[model samples]
Target chain A: MSTQWIAVIGTCAFAFILKFVGHSLPEKWLAHPRIGRINALIPIVLLTALVTINSVTVKTKIVIDHRMAGLGVAIIALYFKLPFPVIVLGAAVGSAIAYHFSH
Target chain B: MSVKRDSFSLSFAVGAYGTAFGAASATAHFSILQTCLLSLLTFSGASQFAVIGVVGAGGSALSAIATASLLGTRNALYGIRMAPILKVKGFKRIVAAQLTIDESTAIATAQDNEKDQITGFWHTGFGVFIFWNIFTLLGALGAQAIGNPSAWGLDAAVPAAFIALVWPRLVDKKTRLIAVGAIALSLVLVPFTPAGLPIITTSLLAIVVGWRA
Candidate 1:
């Protein structure tokens, strides 16, 4: 295998190892109030960051485009308690339409 | 119960998102086998994208690994939170750990009872795994047959799905405050930092908020 494949495999191993090691840690340690609370909140933080970065960044630069419109519509859909697929399709089709009009 | 329904829907939605990753890796010039392997073995969505993003930019495999590993670190954290509830042993532990990604951990924790949590964990973990891999092949073939995924706006699909996941969880003032903080911190850092770095840096805010909360 090439270096890229090696890296991919190694990274894959490292991920599983992290999961294994985490499971091995003493439950009492993670049970600490602060650690537990933060761990619970970590998903929110990570997902927020992921959504923001994905929506805004293109290459090395910050380019706001129809993706933002799609995100906006999706956020609105979320507030309205629209079912999941509608949210996904709304963003996809919404942005496609915005891109169609914009360009 | 509602939890199982949510788990099934969430897994299916996330599984369908493999189409985005397949198209993305294909667009980055990964061979069909490599794309499928990334989904199967690496299996984490953000890290897979990070690998493709880094490698696509002509970075070395080592650099790609480093970037992807940074994103994958959160799964370890998820594992930490889940280990108690999951409580697997030997080979079962390995299976549990492999399934211990963002979606599984989130859905499992959302449950009010331990039995339901375990059910949610397996349903989501395995469900996403099975569906995600199958759709990945479909996406790879589709990408090769068709043209640019971005032309069809498939690039936005993953984020769209992710937003739906995070939306329902923002249930209170404190959670909302921290999310707003994380997003603002991430956006401010976007211009100054590299592609994936801003996301990691936003964790600093999570830390501060978690500390103060």
Candidate 2:
């Protein structure tokens, strides 16, 4: 089989395992106080990883760039309690403008 | 309740990124069908990009798949959280599993109440699926029409979207400290690791910090 197909199969298997765990687990376990507390922390950690990883890039040498300017704008929007869509648009516009001006 | 609206919102939210992916697939000489199928089926942004990036950079297919698989490991954790809420049986569970992605899982888990969680998952997942596919097709069809994704600064959008998702929840000093420390660690390690490993490593570090603090 082609490697892409093999990858797809592996991904599908992984997805199945995830679904089995998510969909079939007992309610008692899911609602367990400890689980809830741990779940609460999941978002904070996941989002931190997501944001930080997406924001930075390495060129020939590592240098901080304007890519994170959008993240900054989004942070400001969130601080002001803007809606999610609005925050995204504002950040997109900010990043686009920053990219345009930086070059 | 509002499956159509949710689908629309998800598509609109994630469609641009999907389009970028489609464009990249095209640049890599992948067919439109392959691009669309990948977006529709794979659905995880980072993993898909990592796979494609590896291919575009002349890496072997095995390397690309390994990268995708490594990046996708987090979906297992998402599943662990979502298991109880889905409540499907047999065949339905399979379909639901296919639909679960980062945004839908996050929205569902973040909801304060049960009703909201169900709504959030259905709306977000349905929306992202429909829109992601549509934009993937659009991007593939108009690959040349779209400028370089990098030049358009689309790469910045992912972090911007994530910050929008995350920054609102930071209500305390400890969380902020963990976030700062995690970012610093991620930055330090990004150069030394593969594409997405830094995020995973930094997440583990943040979890440790959060556990201790």
The lDDT for every candidate, in the order shown, is 0.76, 0.63
The regions of model 1 sitting more than 4 angstroms off are A1-11, B1-14, B24-31, B45-88, B101-124
**Residue range B64-148, candidate 1, lDDT tens digits:** 6765676677787778888889888999998998898989998999889999999999999999999899888887888788775
Among the numbered candidates, top lDDT falls to: 1
**Per-prediction backbone clash count:** 0, 4
- What level of docking quality does candidate 1 show? medium
> Which pairs, if any, clash in model 2?
A22-B83, A23-B83, B7-B127, B11-B131
Error of 2 at B205 (Å): 2.2
How far is B26's C-alpha from truth in model 1 (Å)?
3.9
Which residue pairs collide in model 1, if any?
A: none
Question: Candidate 2: lDDT over CA atoms?
Answer: 0.63
**Candidate 1 chain A TM-score vs. reference chain A:** 0.77
Worst 10 residues of 1 chain B by lDDT: B51-60
